[model samples]
Target: MSHRHVAAIDAGTGSGRCVIYDLTGVAVGSAQEEWTHSAVEGVPGGLDFDTRQNGALIDRVVAAAIRDAGLGATDIGAVSTTSMREGFVLYDANGEALWACPNIDGRARVQAERLTQAGISEDVFRIAGDWVSLTAPARYHWLKEFRPDILERARYMGMLSDWMATRLTRTFFTNPSVGSSSALFDLNTRQWSDHLFERCGLDRAIAPQVVEAGTLIGHVTPESASRSGLAVGTPVIAGGADTQLALLGLGRKAGQATLVGGSFWQMTVLTDYPLVDPSRAPRTLCHARPGEWMTEGIGFLSGYALRWVRDAYFEPILSAAGSDLEAFDLIEAMASAAPIGAMGVVATTGAPMQSDNWRQPPLGFIGFDGNTPEHALGNLARAVMETGAFLANSHLQKLEELTHQRYDTIQFAGGSARGALWPQIVADVTGREIEVPVEKETTALGCAMLAAVGAGMLDSIDAAFAAMASPIERHINPDPERNKLYRDIQNNWADVTMAASRMAECDLFEPIWQPPGAKFTSMTDIRKV
Candidate 1:
């Protein structure tokens, strides 16, 4: 009650970190331990990482953050974690990860296909408010059927955060956001489903205990404290998946929506009630907002698509002259060089030009006659950004059918949202007024707020966000002129999508994957080929 503090062990695909937040929802201290994700190229490429190493990174960074905060483990009030979802760590009785699988490692598509074949997926979706995914629960299916040997030694298959929480508190529990990612939990009941358990051939225990975010899970154990450098008795809260954490950091309340525009771009509108889509692009997930859930419209390739253009095409000029810190400086300069529509050079969002089926290729060139990189660069940037916006717009229209609500303004937070020009373009393209929060790392703030609620410093997540939240600083209103032009571009992009879908139906441009044999042991084994 004296002074409240919270900590986050952010387990990312590439790194793990310990972040400290004060009562005001500001980061007081932070420390990072880098990790790597290994991949074998196919559709998603086999995105794999060393789970044990990631856990070690968590221990190292937590110690560093405690030291940086000028406090030992005992001073912190509570701790929670935000982590990459879908990857499950199989545990033995000793709480050690016998083995693990990364999320959407591009291998579970077959299992997802199998679920589709069984016709039980639709039932799972109707009840769980989750679509069958090539991750998490489907992963259990793949493992149980394919790797019976490994399953013999495995007991619990929990997300990275759940495993870490169990490691700290000596109790196994799951957060709402993480459980939703499982594709097995009934969003309405907020618990595991007998329907899904039987469908996937998974055990009921495979469903971890669901805990509401901001619940006081427990204190760190002596063993965890010894290694993590936090006090053994420091309270730990049930945090959530990183996106939900980011949503919290963004100060999501009952009504406000969040735009997470990192490598992938997702726009979410929250409601306690969720509507699920099976065949279409707009998918829904449980929101980090307590008593409420959210519907997510995601674009797989947003920032990464633009980065590809920056590298494969503009690297010689941009890289030699500009760095990532200064990337926007160069990109904006280049964007300004091009005209409004990049001389009719249309950009795409993975319709016809689906590279690895994630991102659309560079903006299709129409009138490329002696245009410099500066002139061409903006078109590519605009195209990718607009195409992404158009895709999000398509989803927004679809999700409105379920929410019976519309977002008047979008709160943009991400690396790309920092750019003044791109944000305006996003606003103009989406035709919605965009509000940029004071802090871009809303996910971090979101996680910390949940932790605060768990620590009993705040009664509710909404109250914590409302009391701590401030007004937006930068705002972008849709320009009448650019909005009109982008509308036309959006129409063109729709035409492109229709054509691509048709071709895919015709099987003219199809790709096939014959699953690798068990000979494919590690990501490394597949990578060397």
Candidate 2:
């Protein structure tokens, strides 16, 4: 018997993927394409996205998925898309994009500093539930400061997924789940804050109409259908941000914390109301489900570091195998053979940083005794894994302190959770049980679930999730002995991190060096050392 299917587009930091799934949560066809942001000369952390090019690629990938599925456009019930949060595109009145900024774009650091200095940081945190990072506020600030002409001509500002939905369906709508990441969103009122727009020197009218997830934005236009091989009248679902969508895919509920182990690590807990605590500093945002909230601590550099180490160091050794799975296997084998505590080496992932503070923790190892490359590789892998664990535990503690809630189980997903050792490490370090679900592409599954809901195939998101979510595949329980060892390690790591922060605060390494014959007046001079 032929089964019904839905298409989902997942646009991530480095790549875009389209997957078609059956109603039983089984992936029937899939395709992926890697896309990169163009680099600008002499601009540190500057990246530009071209939506026209990206939209075309999205069409191609979605068409490819339909072809691979061996189904016609009429067979697919609906289409939905999810993307990385924070990155946005500015459009003119004609709906043509002027400039696009991804989440990685950091050209607005100067403006961000300006806001911090002007005491706008506290106000933003109170209203938006987050500190000023490289998101909309800073991007808008940069546009107002450097490119005022473009700012003057701007008619629409939207997150990347919202822009995609508009291109496909000719409707401009953004869900509160993605809006939660924008510094302009008001946490209390669940709407755009006029005060934030005034402070950022942007007009609130530039923002799109806010909607909830699972809402039918519009039907695919004929032009889009021709380009994407989707039905002309296919219902387009308003999917939310990638992280929250993944949580929805997991069928998450209140009282559960989810660890999305991707290139960036986020430990998020679902809540019934907005919980804003500057002391905790975890991001508080609206959940994909209406009337729910999510608080998270993110590690921006954890899994990316592991991927870098693998590609730079281990890939060559396993190049003959021509399989990433084999390389990961070797990495896991080496790490498992290494002595506990990585032979007295500690590597930090440089995450959970405070933007308001000037001092940042250094990213790397503190203790290394010139070990062999293999030993170092093993230790490096262990360090990377431990860094994720440390960050997760830190966030868990912060959430517990702020909400007075105890989280004993962490539902895990994303690319990093594929291996057995990493999950074990996380369980051991966090001292919590790790539950792994059957689906590997949780984000894609989430979009598909939303599509089903929008197409009337499912009554609601909860109903869709209950119908499609597969059973838990594996469970990792913490080892008592390893948990004790991790506690001590965490304490020591804390002490070293404090020392580093203090050193940075004092600018200890910035003193000028005195050359020979130069006058050195004090013993604290670099020449004295």
Candidate 3:
């Protein structure tokens, strides 16, 4: 029988999911499981990716998805993978897993400082379009310093998605979209940079072969087929980074801006050229589509912050609801009932993106009146949601300055876009039209598009998207009065966050988040470029 379906495996920061889609882009089946990366003992910000455990989870999700589709494994024509970027896995000569860490891992502070102090960070940023903080070079140096034994036996390094593709086909290869995030690729060349390895004192031999997304890598091995419920000889395709792939699935054309809001909120603008910010405030990564590049600014843990508020303060509401979706709906309804400024409650949950000086103030709510409904949970939640919009507006301003272009409309995707209230808030805060697609899981859909291309069901990545991608389901227009109020509120929020950051500097409070090696000696040093 002719194969007419494709599968996508996605390993995200907080979860793992498998989605099966037919040639027409319709999702036939899906399964998802939440997972966590544990912090390493004695390491301040180290988060370890348990390969053995996560691998099992991946297997279970894939098998469950195929079963949910009510189709035989042989029906899947191709498989592709995508994941949270920056996280990587190491392998020994015999292909055994050595060590792995998630994207949020920050065990290499000293190594990152060494590179920065030596003035090598500028060179890496200039070539790779990324900083040294969470990239591969610093992590490799950390291994060399603290875990030399493991490094000695390691033969290859691959990103999380690359690891998934390798497990299926037993082929070690990486694509530019994720590879560029490692600080090991030459942005212009879209390949591994030998100079970067030499400068970082890392072995060049560990670099994997660079391939473009949607390229056919190899056939799935029998062992992987048995474990994942995939057919042997199924084609495995190289996939790109999650954000970039999500852009592809959203049909983002050149000169368009998109906000991907999930565990982290990424503000990305597509450009025809690989433009590096001279100030190094934003990150640049290769797009899933060849000859394209994306300048990105990130809001740290925006979605996670919202989740914390829900779990910590709204458990009663959650218990009363039938499902998480229902709970979120109720939360949105409450937020909608609150006035625009959220009753003067300013939430400093997310900071504006600064790749070179990444940090966040302590997550908090300020200026609430306990005597009035200003202290209500609905107002607090609305303030938290508004912080995400404030951060997005900040990033969009920076991107506009860098690109010398103004975006009149923005494409919003990811988990946050599913809520009508959040999207409207974003539109009002940014004073831009917001378009949300029918499918929120654009990352997995983009990976499936690549699978379709690799399986010869589509002519190219663009063709696959044109043939299968969903159309925009809704458009949100900013209310003029609300926009004016948000503009004033955002300014006050910025001032409050800066004061909070100073409190962290004084040791009176702890930062909600900061990258490894990020240090600001004074208030002036903490300012964005």
Candidate 4:
């Protein structure tokens, strides 16, 4: 095969990014487009995105990445796409998109209820693994029940990655990475669930034919060639969800784990078999590789929590700043000053922080006191970071039991990753040696690697990761002095968080609670120092 560079297009929750990677996996160029997701019908939480607008932006961003690479798109060996999982656009027989509702859109609550009423809902824990939430099965069922006319017109339904693959190659297909997030795919069978389709009244045919993560779907057609600057007939590969791709990019294997410290904070560890946790189900996604799954212990907050603290709790500090740079400096300085334990601080909240449980309000400072940093916000910042570590560790312990493997190190990535202090804090708080990637934006690199692997430019996913992976930026060894403090705090925090759920158990929307707390605490105390 002829040599070719890899191009990655990521249509994500917050923005769109196109990146070009050389054969060695070093990034040469990239471009990004950040768009605001306006609520449909001008109502609150009626979340939606313009698929066409995002689609056009992908086309433009790819062109920019190519231009920045000092080569035309035609120079690229292969193209692959990655995206946030579970959202889909309905397409007519002619490939026209109906309204593109994002995965978190709330318009389908009633539709979801209908599926439950139809006995379509199983134990959620047994058949499907973990928190089923608005996974693809429910999303497709929503269309069938609420928007039947559109459902009738849909010759195809697809995730953002699959849709882009279709746009580039004019063929509808899916890879295991995307399929794992869809409730339609049975974790045991590694194929679409006939039972789920029959109960939801969904046409399995509307879903694309499933393939492995590195499969080449087709070549770029002439129309896309003109718009994207990629040559006509250029190979396009079907890749994966952004998070899963990032896991692979971080060199995570079935026995290892990686953590992301971004808008959404998550820890993904490789598991030989799927774990069954009803409460943790919403956060879990099956692995793309057959008989291998990723036991993801994640939450919806982290860096975004920091952004919230800056805006709400610390808005006065931001407003008094002379400039943007000065304001950012002040925030960092505050985080630096905050002592490790945040001085008896308990819980620092942000952005509703919805789990499988109650809808907590935005930005709550629970267990506040006179000792709490009032004007001095360092305590709050430390608590926020500490909360992140504690929460992350919360999931890791469960995953270890489910996978029957222990993680020696945790890999870090994303915007918050630039802060060296956070890694040490994570290490001290979680008591794990931290590995941070030198090259940031690994999600982009992961997609490029997938494209290369799919294009047959690389032998296997492991080989692709080897070719594209970078050296570790820095290492943060856990401080034995602080580890004891963090361990006590982590135990208290976990138990307190658990105890407080009883106050919320009365709420209709909360997750069903079970006891014993999952043994995450023992792992903290038993860490090999």
| RMSD of each candidate relative to the true structure | 6.4, 6.2, 1.9, 5.1
Error of 2 at 243 (Å): 1.1
Poorest 10 consecutive residues of model 4 by lDDT?
514-523
Q: Which residues of candidate 2, in runs, are more than 4 Å off?
A: 1-3, 320-325, 353-355, 358-363, 496-529
Tens digit of per-residue lDDT, candidate 2, span 1-529: 2338999998888787799999878889988888888876666556788787888889889999999989899999988888888888888898878888776676776777677677776778888887776568777877787789998999988788787787788787788888878878997777888999897677889988888899999999998888889988888999989888999999897788999987778888888889887662577888888888888877765677787777877898778668656777888888887766787677744544343442345556767786676698898888778877787787787777787988889988988888888889999988899999888569889889999998898888888888888678999999999998888887776666556544543666321111111111212110100
* Candidate 1 accuracy as lDDT: 0.67
Clashes of each: 12, 0, 0, 4
Structure candidate 3, residue pairs in collision:
none
Candidate that would win on TM-score: 3
Tell me the tens digit of each residue's lDDT in model 4 across 229-268.
8888888987788788777677666778888766667778
Candidate 1 Cα errors over 4 Å, as ranges: 13-15, 32-36, 40-45, 64-73, 278-280, 307-325, 346-370, 497-529
Report how far off residue 110 is in candidate 4 (Å): 3.4
Question: Model 3 segments beyond 4 Å from truth?
Answer: 320-325, 371-375, 519-529
Best by lDDT: 3
User: How many angstroms is residue 519 displaced in model 1 relative to the true structure, after the best TM-score fit?
Assistant: 28
lDDT per residue, candidate 3, 145-234, as tens digits?
A: 889999999998899999999888888999999999899999999999999999988899998999999999999999999899999999
Residue 429 in model 1: shift from native, Å? Answer: 1.0
lDDT of each: 0.67, 0.78, 0.88, 0.69
- The residue-level lDDT of candidate 4 at 272 comes to 70
TM-score of 1: 0.85
